[model samples]
Target: MKRPGIVLAHGKWDKPPYAIGTLADALRAAGHPVLTPELPWSLARLYDASFHDALLILDAAAQALRRQGCDRVVLGGHSMGANAAIACARRHASADGLLVLGPGHFPDWLHQQGISTDSLARAAHAVASGEQERLTLTDVFQGRPRPVRIPPAHYLEYFAADGPAVMPDNCRHLESLPLLWAVGRADAHFDLGRGYAYALAPPHPASAYHELEADHIGTPQAATALVLAWLARTFPEPA
Candidate 1:
């Protein structure tokens, strides 16, 4: 097979348009063909029953990559997409690695599935207050990560499930892919403890976490650069 490429996935509230394209350009510059897809109605269904749709999107990406002769892929994502990428990588015949940048909503995702985060639960009143503009969110997102003003249907679709549902768990098999979990230490929406990455612990032993001195907004750029560097070292491009 040809040298593997990188597949980048984005999270809720963000469109897969220029955001992904721009990252693709950077990865291309790094010498790896990148596959970034427009997740199926993800922007609208993030809050709805879109988890199934999200899972399908991941499958479609893999199929698309395989058809393009990219069977060996390095799955990567920003925020929520990281979760999807992990699910996708684990479902297929395994991958080179899982690179997650600025993982978000992990606490809420887990909570929906009844995995309450005491840290977040401590802020229960605030969390349920429905505060449109939360200082905490601003602190984490920096540039103001608002509740994507999409249609109610779309919003409902977005959060279709209370998650951290362990997409890989469904198949009863974990992908032995290496993992590169990068997070901005300044990210307010991200608390490593709350991320509950413990589930990702042990097993393969080919994983590492790096803390960038940036918040959620700054993570994408920095994480992109880091991913490029790692992909070059791990899945080096054609000579």
Candidate 2:
């Protein structure tokens, strides 16, 4: 019996195919096929693509998994990658399951923190003025101020308060697929609790929320056992 294919996305400002390497390796060793895509928000690319473009990248990866003989596809991600996975599931509606670890990239929260407010305004102005040059924007990367250069139009798509990356809104639009949302106990976003976004997802018998003993970056590795158990239960091997 074939096991489900998994696409794991890396977090914002993190390197590709290695940021979530621990979890990806575990899943592969457990007999699941996994692909860790270098997302648009990765450290190397640094917002080279819009949030919508990131979804397109994920869509292509899912298709590749289907071509490789996977009977089912699951989308998993860490930090901003987790946020993107939720958006991808909402926009594509093709994934069979969702695994989110320490979901990050909340534009509204950023606005409240006063981190991207000025940059968002600048990006909006640049887009409105039809500027093509990339602008340096401030972002909270790993809990500190980091400067990222991105074209204004593309930046708006990611940092806009009501942009497509809003997890709660995205989770609300999810179909009947099962979800596994895991956050670290020491992670800052953990305080948001399930009510922040997990609770908004349509109820599914297999959906679950967990709190691990790790911080934001350490969540993927810490939740390995929990994730494996959940996968085995939710997607048993065919007889």
The most accurate candidate by lDDT is 2
Give the C-alpha miss distance for residue 195 in model 2, angstroms: 0.4
Per-model TM against the reference = 0.68, 0.97
The best candidate by TM-score is: 2
**Runs off by more than 4 Å, candidate 1:** 16-21, 40-49, 92-94, 107-173, 237-239
For candidate 2, write residues 68-163 as lDDT tens digits: 999799998999999999999999875999999989988878887888899999998998898989888887865688887889998888978889
lDDT for each residue of candidate 1 in 100-164, tens digit (9 for 90 to 100): 77765443344454433332433344446654332221111223434333333333223334333
Q: What is residue 182's positional error in candidate 1, in angstroms?
A: 0.4
| Residue clash pairs of candidate 2 | none
Angstrom error of the Cα, residue 28, model 2: value is 0.8
Q: What is the lDDT of residue 177 in candidate 2?
A: 83
